[model samples]
Target chain A: MIQAVLTAEARTPGAARLHAALMELKYEFIRLMRTRAYSLSVLGFPLMFYLLFGIGQRSSAAAQYVIAGYSCFGLGSACLFGIGLGIAFERAQGWLELKWASPMPRLVYLAAKMAASATFALIVMGLLIGLGVTAGRAHVSLAQAAELAGILLVGSIPFTALGLLVALIAPPKAAAGIINLVYIPVSFASGFWMPMRMLPHWLQAAAPALPTYHLGRLALGVFGLASGKHALEHWLVLASCSVLMFAAAWITFVRSEAKSP
Target chain B: MSATAPAIPAAAPPAPLARLREVTKRYGQLAALDRFSLTLRRGEVTALLGPNGAGKTTAVRLLLGLTRPDAGAAEVLGRDPRSSAARTAIGAMLQVANAPDTLSVREQIELFRSYYPRPLATAELLNRTGLAALERQRFGTLSGGQKQRVLFALAICGDPEVVFLDEPTVGLDIQTRRQVWSEVRALAAAGKAVLLTTHYLEEADALAHRIVLIERGRVVRAGTPHEIKHSIAARRIRCRTRLTAAVLRELPTVTGVEADRDGVVIFAHEPEQVLREMLPLDETIGDLEVSAASLEDAFLALTHTS
Candidate 1:
């Protein structure tokens, strides 16, 4: 259904129309980068998490675990932080109507927004990799480092899609609360904040249900830790979750744009 | 009726470029546009005029396809606004200039220009909107009027076939406002349809080929400015006369009369004939003044009465 809608928007939509949508996307991207909220959340929380968990701890094993956890959790937050919240705010403040009135292709607008958010997610991954290897003393092989980068890049999809979906349904100010409600508790439940071995059996059983949990387990694998024989299952779960979130977000976004004033 | 009348067959009046057929947007129980219907044509400017809750914004929103009419259809360029094909023909400048504050005005225009496939030159946009010198200034640092010009620049960047401007001159100085008015006129002259919503009566009266007066979510009157001004048909006559109250009341055309320090003002349907009758009775009508009905007065009478 989503593909059909996008395809229809593209059928003979002139270069000028798609260009207009891309321009709106570029503006949205640059605007998000310059905002204090985006800068602080993107760069600040990861730094704070690194300090409180990795450096502040005494044990090397604890520090290593913290490195893995903070890298996964912080990158997840970064993916959703600005794009979702910013979109919600734009909707609340009535900027969406301006876009609706322009000679811009609506699908291209969403496509560009997703692209911008993915770019920011890449920046967050780079921050995590630099901080994890340098200051946190997490030793890594070359293959593992590459895998970790790949994990951050691939793992960003679900959250980015989720952020778009949340922005679709939530009000601007409420987006932060909604994202936190989804991210923090899910991170804790998924054993990203603590080792799954140390978690209760019920939590261990339910962790795989979350996209973030699968992502964290995958990250643990990059750190040379065993994510169990069901690691393939985790991969499938994350892929399916990402697809589902993308579909949901796309549907909600279209409906919201259709109804917006 | 000349034989050489261009053999044009009088090209039947162009179909309305836009029309709202019984459109209504309801937020729960509040009707933003209560069964509103309006028409706009190519190369013509139609002003949407109303007070705060009179549904002017709602009508604009519906026409832009930002909000769907709960009951009716809003057709722009002969297509639903929600459709991309329909939207390509539109250029709009809503209330706020919500571009990134960090981007320079030039960057902002360039960015917006990229959204359209064939955009106007950035320099031309800046010059047309009167932002030539301020092009390199950051968006946040620009004054409100300057930002508005940039927004206008963005609106016209694509050179759309139809333009919707909602209060485009709200914060502008007189000179800036005049410039925007000329731009609006120029757009129409170039054969683009223009729809504007303004609180300024003069803007509607001066720029719009037709004015749509909305009150409480319904269009109470829609016609040329002349027709709208004459909608109420209440012309005023002021005379500094010593005519007795009985004499003024005796005139059948005088609908109402009240005394001011300088004179007795009369509101009559036929002010010219009524004042002529009173001329012989009061030679001391030194400060006498007569003015035809105005759009402002017409608006007050229409909206305030109903």
Candidate 2:
């Protein structure tokens, strides 16, 4: 009876893994989309801010400049709120334990969150570009627009990595509050809303420490609004941040797992 | 060769579908499971019956691979419980304070079903769980019992051969609790190995083919419900009498006396003899009731001596 009762399925095929991955992605997207507050603000924040300050008696460079800055802002918010808060809340709810008990690969759970965050970041960039072009009077060529989208897509990775660590550390009930505490200050310090030249000297000097500032530089460079730093330098910083944070988060996770017993 | 005959040899009994062999799990200095061992076979439901902090949930966690045992082995289908192949054959409904409330019941079931190679159809899972009418309802909007059913749907939707349910009926009403018991019985009837942990003694009596009473990481008693119940061999006499437990203990054939909200319940091998002595001494006795001893009496008796 035991032998017959057991599911004698063969090894998981590649197709099953692919299907699992896709399903994980689909649900991750749906999970975030249903949270009206999360989806609406992550999408609307950049567009609304651009309307407020990116246009009206703006220079051609200024309109484009605000587009680049707010696009980076949107990407940062999406990754932080979506990936960070999402993981923290799920982990707190004991939902992660159920997933771990299932046959779903652990990597798929993480990869889905990263992919979903990137998707939201890209959507916000699209919306911001549309707003900039129509009412804000900002001009963006197809090549530049593609470059902007690429920047957002890749730029979300380091933030995703950072989000992992935050999720691990933040208390579940206060995850949202804690994320905002870090998110708002870093965006302002990184000059996501204003040009670096206009920021206080200390703030500008401190901007390089945050990864979002590097992403901000990459976004600004699409419209030739970046400072004198080479575009390669920004890539190096972002890439290094992604690797380092991922390693740190992985180590932190492993240590916590060990300590639980 | 024909001289020796096999008259009526039955087929060999099936091996355990899931087992924890001499497992010891420790958290800091306190051992959650000390040399613990358990098994589940197909077509039978096993209940890990214990009070809170009695290591019942810890044993469930070890079997689910949510936590590793400090010593010994946890196995399912001849593989480590943590392995993907083993997990694919297993379903679990853990004690979660909140499931993701945003998704509708159907959506949650569908998502869990996608994790397995062979899964029950959405309609079938819905039908089995009795959630057909509420499939469109979000988990957040469900009552406590309905949410528990949704979790149960997620657990069984994978058509798993072995299922682990950790305190599945906690906080549920008695009617809902009975509904869960019926579902558990169905799982056993369908020949799926089911292991559930519960503090509810009646739940263990109603659902489990075998019950293991754990205390402080040790199995104090493990037997069939009938075997355990019959072992006490006592009748329960309940009454609001002026006689205290200390006074009741002096009487003959009195095995145990427990003070509860109902009243002072006296357990004895001869209830009539105890009553003859008790009633005259306390003429004020009221709400007198007598019945056969139950599992709770067996528990109180076990605790009194142990």
Candidate 3:
């Protein structure tokens, strides 16, 4: 009976693989949604920030620019806290040990997290655009709204790669503190909270090097609010940041695996 | 305590479902597993009994492909442990296995179930682990024992042929620990190859077909619990008697005697002879009981010899 049961287990490998990947993705999103703190902060921060800073302004231009800027902020927060702190906590609890030991493909685990991060970013972008055209009364056409959503959704990837780097470098207990210390200040200087042109000259010079700045510029470009002549340069910087961060994360993870329980 | 149930004999000799052949893992200058070898066969529970830092966790990690051995091969069903085919047939309940606090018990099981081609039914999996009633509870809300039961449920949900349980009952209350032991027995009875690593000797004695005592990354002794007990060649005689330690010590083959709250405990290689001599001399003798030296005694003796 035992032999028969063991022999009967492996059916079509392709079907099992596909189903496993989908289940992983589905549950990851479900879990993320159920987390009130994550859902509230990822969605709440930008919504709250937009309401406080964007509404009741003298002209709709400030409202329009802040809407685009806050969307980028929402997108980065979702990736950094969701993927960054989530992985560090999981690794600390030895949860990754169990997942690694399982038969689920490594790619499936990574893809599920990336997809969840993107989906969270998408929801934030969608809500912000809905409010941008209505309550904020920020003159956003439907075509421009679609373009803004496209920028933020595609923008989640570069931030997700950065999140992986945070997971690798930060200790679990101190991960949130470390990410916030760097993320918030960088977000401020990168024009996530406001336009960089009004910032001190030193921060404006450093803004171009930061990935958040590149992403913010991309989002603002949707509303004809971007200043720089070369739009493609922003994509190039974000892409380079993603590649470098991913490579560093991979190397650190491989080296850490060599010295484990 | 009595062994839970009689051991089932495999039909002919079974091939090892997993094996670590002379695996040596090192951390800088310190070697975690020094040419260590272990084997797991179907329908058998092989307990890797050792103290902390005895390389027990390293052995499990090597078999699970969580870490590669520095010098030797780790294989499951004749395939590299890191290979997808090999891992598909295996399941592990690690020391600190956990999931997101927000996920419900049922959701965690569902996610793990999807990883296998032939996972156990949701109801059966819950029922077997006594987790059906609490299936909808969030993982963070469960008590410590309940959390452990959920981890156990996840380990076997995959219908795995080879299960690695590293310290499966650590930090659990006695009742919950026994429950886990019985479930582990059920897994073996169903013909799965179970490899358990634990520092608790009675746990091994209760559930294992074989106990391998490890120390300093080496197998100091390996045998059935009965065989391990016999190496000491001594029995403990506990009785409610008026006999003094000095008097009991004079009995034939009496190696040592000590006072107990109830009465006296006499250690002797030939317990029957000692009892016969003590019964006639002490008219108040009652509650006489003789049992072989425990595995703890065997382990200490072997560690000393090695």
Candidate 4:
């Protein structure tokens, strides 16, 4: 029995690879759950912001807008801080080196992080939707709610790529602070806390350039709460940003490896 | 030949499990490994002994394919170390590594085991490493010794044919150090090739089948423990005597002397000659002790001159 268990052919290569990927996902999930401060902030901050600003509004439309805005804010924070700061800290700790030495595929490592961020995005969306329905007096059908949830979850990808770029470029010690600096400014400018029309003219014009702006627009468009002009263009811009950031991340990763051992 | 003569097949020596042939690795102006070479074979334990910055870690990194060598070749299981096939056949415990803090010991082991196509049973691994009782404890909460043992367990979880342990017991209490040493010995006894690196001379002498002493990116000496001890041809003589260190240094075979609380300790090339001369010079000499030089003494002598 031991001999059979020790043989290399005991399991198919494909099955073993899948098992390894799942294990990475499981462990990453466990790590995120155990870090109470990070989890609470990523999941709670946006909900708190929504409750404070959206709850007392007499206008249901205003409440709906705040819901859409903060949903983008919540998911963006999850991807940016979760992937960005997490990777930087792991590299500093030499955990990345250990993982590279193991037989675990590099893609699986990144995929696991992305999956965990997406899970958090779903949780934040669920909580925001619940608060919007009960306290904010927003009316939405089940289909619309599911569609908005899907959009927000999918919108997290671009931010995850951006986070990876930050992780690869910044020094680990300064990564968290730098990410926070970037997160707040970008979220505000992108109208994730308010509507783009309320900002300065120049800031409103530049809103479309930020991926968060495009993501929030898409979220609002799902409920017919905002203009749907060039919805495809919004997706195109976000997708293009994702592609560019991913390429930059890959380049930075290769360069760092060459610079080190 | 007569038909009744029995045919005898010629025996062949098995290939080395891992080899570094004239490998050279450099960082900026400093050469971490300069034209270094070593081989590891099945069921053999080879210890790379060196002081800090002696390039022992560099050599292990090159062999594990974590870093590429500048000049020559390194192979594991007769294939380039970078190949997945070669990597699958080996396991390594690096000098600087820690598992995820939130995961329990068993979870960590299970995760690592899933990476390999064939892995040892988790129960057996925990039992062998004496980690069964601490199976559910968080990795971050474990003591330093327990953490090292967990790393050891991960290194062997894959049932690797060759294992690399880079300074496995650098900082540990004596009892914990001994526990890790015995586990390493057990790995070799199971017919696996083991390569260990450490600056602790006693560790190398106690656990290694062959010791290779490295200094400044080159192997200064390589031999068995007995051969290394005899190579120096130095002996130490300690006795409670009235002679001062200055008088003892003047003896023919005595090269150095130091006065201690016990008496005077004499370092001599020939202990017998020193002994012959000592008794005649002092009538009150008593409680004499003569012993061969230890590996530590040999290590210092070799590294200091080169």
Q: Number of the top candidate by DockQ?
A: 3
**Residue pairs with clashing backbones, model 3:** none
Quote model 1's iRMS: 4.9
Give the per-residue lDDT of model 4 (tens digit) for A134-179. 9787776788778888887778789889989999999988987898
TM-score on alpha carbons, each prediction: 0.82, 0.90, 0.88, 0.88
TM-score of chain A of each: 0.78, 0.92, 0.91, 0.92
Model 1: runs farther than 4 Å from truth?
A1-26, A55-67, A134-136, A168-171, A177-186, A197-210, A235-261, B1-15, B22-31, B70-72, B238-251, B254-265, B276-288
Docking class of 2: acceptable
Candidate 1 chain B, run of 10 with poorest lDDT: B110-119
Query: Which residue ranges in model 2 land beyond 4 Å of their true spot?
Result: A1-12, A258-261, B1-13, B239-253, B259-264, B270-290, B303-306
Candidate 1 lDDT score at position A256: 61
Candidate 3, CAPRI quality class derived from DockQ: medium
Per-prediction share of native contacts kept: 0.55, 0.61, 0.82, 0.54
